[model samples]
Target: MTPRDGARISGHQYGAGGELCLEYRPDNWEPQFTGAMMIGSAYRLLSGESPSDGEVADVASAHRQTVAQEVRNTKLRLILNTTLLDILVEQPLLQAQPFTLDEHWFAKHWLAHPRRLGSPDAPPIWAAAPPLTEPRTREGFAIRLPDETNVPFEGSYAFLNTILTALNFAPALERMTASDAEMPLLLVHRGTARLYSLAQGTGSRAVYVYRTIVAPANEQRLSAEHGVLADQCVAIVGCGSVGSKIAATLTRAGVGTLVLVDGDLLLPGNLVRNELDWRAVGLNKPDALAARLDDINPSTKTIVRRLLLGGQESSASTDSALQQIGQCDLIIDATADAQIFNLCGSVACAERKPLIWAEVFAGGIGGMIARSRPDLDPPPYAARRQILRWCDDNGIPWTGGDGEQYSLQIDAEKPPLIADDADVSVIAAHAGRMAIDLLKGGATTFPNSAYAIGMAREWIFAAPFDTYPIDLVPEGQWGPDADENARDELGGLLREFFPKAEEAADEG
Candidate 1:
């Protein structure tokens, strides 16, 4: 329709004031919400560094900022949410606050840097947008509710118009008359709790609600059908390269609860491979990883054990750590430590909890994921044995004899060189999917208990490397049934860590 048809059209993607407005019928979303915050923050990625004393903040700044501009034409989108206030009908900004544009505050905070601006001071920075949280725009949401692709528009204008007036937003609506916008609008359907969206459209006053990420439609259907993910609990013993990504993968699959156990602190070197962010340096790996997971999927509950398995000297309570492992539905051994790996396998077997161990082969040559649960037809540790056997069968070099393998570590002392970050991520995805399937009771077909991915194996063999691919011999495999001598070698180091550990060993 033309502008003369009584509808004002604005910009194709953004608004007249650099705002990207969206509306969500909280009930219309896949993972529905009740309320959100529309407080504007700098549109940012990776939450970049803020402006220094006199320097200007980049378009994609991180966290909160305290500066307001009547005209932000240079760049930046103003965002808002229902987070601070729940009711759409009540807004403090609507109570009649005149524009207090202080030139000094604006100049100081505008392109703040040490050369000119001394330090931070108060600056009014508020704008309006729809309340959207934990947005994942790059990825589509897996689920959307109501299943109606076309929203009815027969009689929405009067109610929308009335609500805008009652909420004191009529002024903005009137201004919208002059420009076209691609805005997402959310509203309560028929005054009911259900949310409906007046999605993407080409009018100055239209509200379009879009999300960064949502649950996949198929997965949502499967969730309603079986919900195997919702009922299971997994324990990730490491938050390192393979482990952290595996944790994220399971979360994406709708796993309800995760127990993270790791005592190490995030190192700067870890940024290249692990999921830890720049903000997580020196923090406990499990705790940092847990926070990241919560930000991604609030529905997943994480319990962190920031104690080392060094046994008694570990910062975590020994009893509590063991109890956490004992209680989990499955144990994921991602630590790759002989001590941690053996310990997890032993405990999982003893407790009869399921176990999945995944590791990236030296370099990006390939990787392996081994699964074992109560469903195994063989004896204890069979799952572990099978995965190793599969690795050997596939020509995976687990022995150090194949020369120094590529590793994720930059340390010279650490051998088994490492794979590139991308290759490791590929393996993590393979392992995560297998883990989820095993949790689904293994009725579905899998490549075998021990799954391997050599997608880039040929590339590895092609590269002039220091190592050669060798079979994963029995000695290279660490499973529950391994000789007691191997267990004691590692267990001895941790025994002094916990009194109970020594006692249990003696008793056993």
Candidate 2:
């Protein structure tokens, strides 16, 4: 049927089906009268009678169809959209507002209702049944409406739009119309209320305050902090799991600009722990990570380079990339590539920019954070040498170690020593945490130290004794009474490794 015919049928059905009222509150008297006339003309058109004004009648018929289509489309859309909005808003509101749900009502009704999408095993959307109260809390309304059996038109669009426009304003009703993938009807309503309140008032209230309690003073502080970070820039190397996470976390944290460098592409194997999905497969790692980061925080600027640092192919661009890296306030090394680590460390130290080095063992059991503050002298090569010496002494292996014997041995002692995709997520999360701490300079349990957590065994340890200024020697050093006893414990091992050198020193 033609849209006009459909509208006439709908209008006739609506008027006869129930007690319907149409009120016109136009801004001016002329418009109010005109609107009333239009409604009368629309009724005549529905009854198969043409009005006196041919032009007016034609316009009225068109208007009726447009309005009817919108109302009809909204009914189905409202159920799905509102449900999504309720889910998004409830969590935030329960955390911020004093709201409760009628769980018994929901469990008995909506829980078993086939209309509700998502897994049945998923936790209840509402914690408890909403308390009986006027001017419902944001979360209370969001959750309670879902369980309401008497919703207008079974929570359909036509009924929702009518109620919304009648109770609220036309603008408010307009905002409720969003696409399927967007938030639900109830959330849109709440968001519109919030936006209206903020636009009309002091502009200090939270945009989603009904979902969460946020003070004006806190908002001001956050704004100021963002202003400071917005002008700051960072450079991140090695867009692997840790690097990808660091990039994403920094973007979310409001780092103004980011430079991402990586030599690989997303592969099926990488999806095990990486933030990217299968769609990102075949995409450059740096580009894929940068896109994801931007998706989360569009305000952050990103520059991606898909080339291995210091490689023959990257030789010409290396200088330019290093110059950009030099300009950043912070340079992060998450590649776990020894060569790249040394190169970035050298450049950052030379340029006097703060450098953060993070690495997770193949299985993510052991990770380390090394930061070279601009004010402090560069971390001595001694630490890197010490690591190398330890690796040699312990006979530890690198990624993709030899067959079953080596793998079995490391698994028994340090399950994380072997590269595994499962460990990527753990490494990413830990690396992001460490990077944030380094950037903010906060007290951490393992600040400037290497930490090893055995996931299988649940053992935690901080290496190198967790001492500060391990590189510095004090002028007034005093020996403890048991110092000699402590020395004796290492005497045998030291002598065994340096017998001739110790004898020469003693002779001198």
Candidate 3:
């Protein structure tokens, strides 16, 4: 029947609740409107009547027989299709058909090697004698039987099956005996059939077939020698968009233990970038983030804290938070609060844990990522000082805002500052990569590094500033008093990092 007719009949049968339907057409491999053909044929065979027109009598019995025959034919086609797929998987030769010289050599070596076909301990398949050889007009040589004086075709079953299966032959495995002379002949006669079939089959339609099938094998092999072990504990200090993304990436990359800390509840504003949704609103950010992370990678150990750091509430003190930070191998500062960032950095340094501090500047126009590790010769404090100096030298401003406050300069001629959102994601991702690289021992070339990304300029500068180390002592050699001296040192550092812009004439 025509495709349209088949579709109409299928819809009618499905709507009527018929069983044994055929929902797809094998010709183009598209789904039919419904599986009416199978359903109608099954009904006709059983009831001795025409399912569509409801015709009756002597002719109906004949119709039932015809319907039964059609059913058997359809079943056979399905079985053949399935069988082809199975054969290809079972036989390596079939799976790797259309063999290159390298492939043929490897296969011959593997088949002849004194190893098991199914087990490492099993005996070789061709251990009886050395492989036989036969020359081809264009293809190449095929393995020959030692005892047989006569050579089989060059692209014989042994050679062609491997190529076809590897190329596109479904039911990857095919059974052939000495009696199937045609099987051996078909290989040389139709060398391009398998290749043509592959071009027409699933290979042509796949989005990333090579990556989907081949990349994993390569990744696994490389990972065996270079894969990072997920043994270290990672502490994430916030569960906002940046924090949640970091946590998810870590878990997916096989982090062993993850400690998530955030006091805020999930809100509608958070959904714009957070991993969670409306259902998570009012729930603790850490807990919600942790739950979603667990779903993504169950092997990761997730610990949740529902309290903000450096706040006046319970368990908010620096000492209490430092206790938790001590257990982690690395700490990430993703909170927008400056107090929390300072607190995390201090605790991490005291405990010798590496810290990653990330911030977005200029409403998102620019961002900075800083990495601080105790083992490095120059700690992150030096890098922080350099960044601060760079900001000052570049005349970058920092206007204070309440609750995760950042200073913004409305005029372009003003100092470059952390005043926008453009910097947040860039800094966060950069810091996350730096942290991973550090943990993997891949950052030996550069230590105490900071990367700044400018969105408007589309620029990325690594290690953009010279280091100026600053001590973290409560009382400094710079002054007799502790708190006041510390404030003065910081304020002076800020002013030095961001000098006032010189006056210029208006061109307009």
| lDDT scores of the candidates, listed in order | 0.52, 0.49, 0.48
**Candidate 1 local distance difference test against the native:** 0.52
Q: Report the C-alpha lDDT of model 2 over 137-199, residue by residue, as the tens digit.
A: 221123222233234323334554454554554433444443211222332233321111111
Candidate 1 TM-score, C-alpha based = 0.52
C-alpha-based local distance difference test score of model 3? 0.48
Model 2: which ten-residue window has the lowest total lDDT? 192-201
Q: How many clashes in candidate 3?
A: 48
Q: RMSD of model 3, in Å?
A: 20.6
- Compare the candidates by lDDT and give the number of the best one: 1
How good is model 3 by TM-score? 0.47
lDDT by residue (37-103, candidate 1, tens digit) is 2212122211233335544343421223233432344221222133211332232222322121111
TM-scores of the candidates are 0.52, 0.46, 0.47
**Candidate 1 deviates by what RMSD?**
18.2
By lDDT, is 1 or 3 better? 1
CA shift of 426, model 1, Å: 1.4
Residue 387 accuracy (lDDT) in model 1: 49
Question: Which prediction has more favorable TM-score, 2 or 3?
Answer: 3
Our tally of clashes for model 2 stands at 16
Stretches of candidate 3 above 4 Å error? 7-227, 315-318, 375-382, 396-424, 442-448, 458-508
